[model samples]
Target: MVNLMRYRAEAVYREVSDAGPGSGVTGREADERYSPIDILHDIGASVVFMGDVAEQLLGDSPVWDRVGVVRYPTRRSFIEMQQREDFREKHLHKEAGMAETIVAGCLPIDPPAGHLGEVAWDDVEYPPSDGDGPLMVIHVLRFAEGDAEADMAAYQTAAFAVASAHGARISGWFGVEGTIIGDGRRWDQVRFNLFPSRAAFMSVLADPSRLEAQRAHREVSIADTYTLLVRPAVDSLAASIQSA
Candidate 1:
């Protein structure tokens, strides 16, 4: 699941059945208290990555504070965990602190192959970030009304080509199955690009190939999108997934 959270300035415990963060507390601090690790353990789920937003690269969506990617053993396990009394008690903090949240159940969807012949994704060497460290650029996208899929595929193919050249990888490319938490707005996909450094990501923007792809496919395909850059405390979700 990919979580996009927008926290309130002050936590508000409204009609919550359980005790949680009270007044005068900032939402971020309050939410910090909402850990239900025991429930997660029981369900065999784990947090893959969690981080604070470093910057917004694109989008008209309201600014969000935090991002999370969680892996679950099964969807049923997730639902059962949510219903557990212990988890519900702790959930009050999230309920009180969150102004809005969007939790998208995701499944990996690799970008189309064959474009980068003889250069497989696995063969690409990903080096540790230099300077301030690696950053993940996340994109939440909603496709346009007509012929969007074809256009997006072409765009992703072209975009991936440019991204790979800049030492970036598609860390998580997901198709949103459903929205567990949302405010009516819907999304089609969520893509993540892990870059070695801020400097490298900046270079991706200046690449002429990226511009050509945007004009040729991206602009026509995506109707709405949010592109966020974040420095995750857990740098590599792929490592965790692979080990699991």
Candidate 2:
């Protein structure tokens, strides 16, 4: 079996908007705006073999605008894709389209210990798991807006509370500056969180019961939110959820 690390990477890019902070686009519109990034995904398919895509869900990196997830057959495969000539060429366009982006590499630790949730859709059946499971290492990116420090703090506080209450684990959180995306804009902050499974993430983001928590987040969030789910080369590590 391949000792692969699963990843959930998030990228956020801006659409032509006159709105300022707190203006969020609906999930459907976000999908339309993110449609352009699909080309670069072909590269992941080329080397990674089996992979999935999570459109705009959350911004974790400093300058992230668009996010994607890749599951390579091996670490070597992951590395190889990054170095591929075609991928390198395609990346140029990806860089041009986005203002900023965030990416993370993660490992899913069973019995998830610490983590937080940023956003989750309203009605969706997330991947199954018992809630307490492995830590899925994740990389995140966010395009810098007005004040990253203040924005990140608010995002972390609200999101963490939501996730923690539901039993998730957060291993670490860090910030990355600048990116190879080649856009004139640079990233502001990058965050990290490890969850037992996608279900945990969904619970935090979707729970209608948490209306107060969601309302509390009104000030610190962007209208446009995106999320991507990625996995490692190894298949067995996939989290298994019980049938409802």
Best by lDDT: 1
Off by over 4 Å in 2: 1-51, 58-152, 208-226, 234-244
lDDT of 1 by residue, 167-197 (tens): 6766667899999899888899998777776
Quote each prediction's TM-score. 0.87, 0.39
Clash count (model 2, backbone only) = 49
Tens digits of lDDT, candidate 2, 64-178:
2223333333455556667866656544434334333334343333332334332332222343345533334444435445654455456556666676654454433334322
lDDT for 126 in candidate 2 is 45
Give the Å shift of residue 134 in candidate 2. Answer: 6.2
Candidate 1, superposed: residue stretches over 4 Å from native: 15-23, 114-130, 240-244
